[model samples]
Target chain A: MEAPATNNQIPGELGIWLFVAGDLIVFSVFFILIALGQKENADIFVQSRGKLDLWVGVLNTLLLLTASWFVAIAVERCRTGLGATASRYFSLGILCGVGFVANKSLEWGSKITQGINPATNEFFMYFFVFTGIHLLHVLVGIGVLCLLRSVSRSPGLNERRIRTLESGATFWHLVDLLWVVLFALLYLL
Target chain B: MLPFFYMGVFAWSGTFCYRVSLGTWFAWVMLLIYYVVKAIDRVEQEETASAQGQRYALTSCAGLLRNLAHAFGWENELKEKNVDPLFRKSMVFCAWSGLIAIVLFIIGGVILGEMLPPLLRANDPPEEFVRKVNEHLLSIRIGSVFLMLSFALFGPFGAGIAALTRRAEKSPVFSYVQLVFTSCGTLVAVLVAFTWALMAFRPDVYHPTTVQMFADFAYFLAVFSVPVFGGWCVVIALPILLAEEGQECFPRWVGYVNLWAVLLFAPGQLVLFFKEGPFSWHGIVALWIPFVAFFLWILIMCLSMLKAVKADDQVTGP
Candidate 1:
């Protein structure tokens, strides 16, 4: 996206920022809840932390980060009027998103098959609920990426289309950013 | 005056006698008939005045009928006269329905129903659940009555919103969608109240597990049914967000508010997964966040709708 001709210009419409800010505050609360849970059940949390496959978490993190990167480049391409090229980047971003979803489902499926679920323990409860919510975001982000891809393939990007593109990208980054926190909190920490 | 009399008598009977007497029911029926007659009388007056080419002062009942007529897309019939004030007044009243609902829900569902600190946890034993229900049986029954009344007001509240949305659109598709979802959401809320009342209705006769089942149904109905409520928010937000500049139904921030509500409510779906902790029915994410968000959404939408109505008054003049 073109740099704001003036510093006063926000990256996207002001409305999206309102949504982003509200979402971030709620996620902050989720993180705090996790911290409190970990403090109260340190042993259970630690034990459950070991059972998590670190590599799966690592793969998901990389996939989301790569997707975010592709989306960022796509937004820039759209700004430079490279609509065709931008469409390609959005597709790659979508591919990474699909990969993340597939990997996440596999991880969840294996856990379920092993008789581990949200109700198994407090730690798994947090793990499943929080990650599950984040997974929802990923799914939404992929749909949004598809929209951006189609928009990029269209001719003559107008100011409104660009705004839509920017807002969608911002949302995708939010999904990516949230997953990063989820990966660290649920897995590494 | 009659409506006030009806309310006063009903409230007095409900509080003192714990039951509405036959007299109160007769009075309620009379009030309904009065409303219908008064509404028709005003419409006849308007017809005569217009035939004689004289403007008639808008009465309360006539204003309501006009608002209803407008809501049903009969605007062409009333296009000649200045109906802005009447429409604005009715819209304002409809907007306040949401605020009234929030206040009543707090009193009826949270305070009186003893749901807020949650009377029983999801994993609590059935006997414990029954014991608690028995203890608060009177309050629960009374509260459920208030809750049912409060939740039903959402129908009018949603109608107000859909009406405003209809004005902003060239076609009324989203407004209809909003109305449909509003009915669904309102029904879900009323079902919550009904289920709670059922839980307390015959706790002595029913098995402990039966009471527990009722509690489960109530909580799940209230919290876990996210899509209906979320869809309501989405339709509200989408119209505002997609409206062309200067043609928006609500302010852009209001759309964002609805979007935020949709996100906050999503956690409610997790209540189905966890029986305890923050994801449980009684927990912060599952219950508190969504509950608080819903009222806040109602409050914001109410204020915005009121503001939008007032803005219409200025644009169209007195």
Candidate 2:
């Protein structure tokens, strides 16, 4: 999907961007809190960070990135009036989102079975809570993607319908972007 | 004429016995009777005028009162044309309740209750908790009374918002949702104050652990009941966002504000998982952020509702 001829218009409704900016600021605060926690308890953070399954985090990261890509393409296709193709791309994005959720649940389940929980330590506390919150975003994004898929199949897409599609796609990309940051913060950094 | 004679007699009696409470009571009773007579006279005149098919000017006192009511957007007759004047006043009253609640909260929760520096941390020993409650027993009792009154005011404040949402929607579905969540949120807030008061009620008589339990209950209720408050925000935002353009009771940005509030409040849910750190009940993320955001949200909604009321008055020509 080629970029729609570069117009001055911003993608999606302006209200959606307001929500995105607010959400990003909130995640920034969470990131700052994690940094402060790591500063205060460096040894414990590192020890717990070492215990996390690195491969699972990397896989989830890739899954979300791929989902984001599909969503971006779907948005472009909808904009360019290729609604049928956009529907297909939205399904692919939803599939990737489901995979990410399944992979995250397995990782969390394994850790819980190992007697590690949010109450285990300060590091694990931030890890579970922040990632769990991000997981919720992914779930919501999947639901949004499904809605967009139905919209893509509807005939004679109007400006409002296109705007809705773009907004949902923006949210899906936010979920993916946040997960990348979470993956880095929790699993790598 | 009879009212004038009665007023003169009452005024004379009040001046003759000005030092006694009886004079004040007599003065008040006379003023009440004067108003009642004037009202009855005006109603009788209006009835006779309508029966005779002629317009009648109001008597001076009643006319002056009508003018005053219209100036304040308090006239009852405006109800037929646009928003009810009494309903508008109720909305304004409810909107101000948010400010009242914040002021009372600061005084009761922060200054008097010793919650600002957080007298009791989640990890504090039971003895420390009991000792702190004991230290501020009288103040906590007084403060909790203010706190309870403050939180109770949120019921009307929420109703004000829900009432506005009802006007915006074709169906009252979201308004009812908002009302349901508002009750839940208000109950949670009142419960927080009630539990704090209970902790201070008998800290001396109860075991240290029991006082500590009360503290925990208060903080948890305040910070951890996220869904009630968050759901309230969701219902509020949903209607504003979903409404057709130019049909929203609130500006679109207010919906974004509510959504931001929901995100800010989400951290409060983590208070259940941690006894220490930023996510703890006493910590910044769980308590301070949500606490400040909740009041800020109220303040914005209050200002917006006031604006809407003024706009409605303007469009409808008061």
Give me the chain B TM-score of candidate 1: 0.74
Q: How far in Å is the alpha carbon of A122 misplaced in model 2?
A: 2.4
Error of 2 at B30 (Å): 46
Could you tell me which residue pairs clash in candidate 2? none
lDDT per residue for candidate 1 within B183-297, as digits (tens), equals: 9999999999899899999998999999999999998998898899998999999999888755789877678779889999988887776787788899999998888788778
Best by TM-score: 1
Worst 10 residues of 2 chain A by lDDT: A7-16
* DockQ per model, Cα: 0.24, 0.16
Chain A: TM-score in each model: 0.96, 0.96
Off by over 4 Å in 2: A1-10, B1-83
Which stretches in model 1 have alpha-carbon errors above 4 Å?
Answer: A1-6, B1-83
Which docking class does model 1 fall in? Answer: acceptable
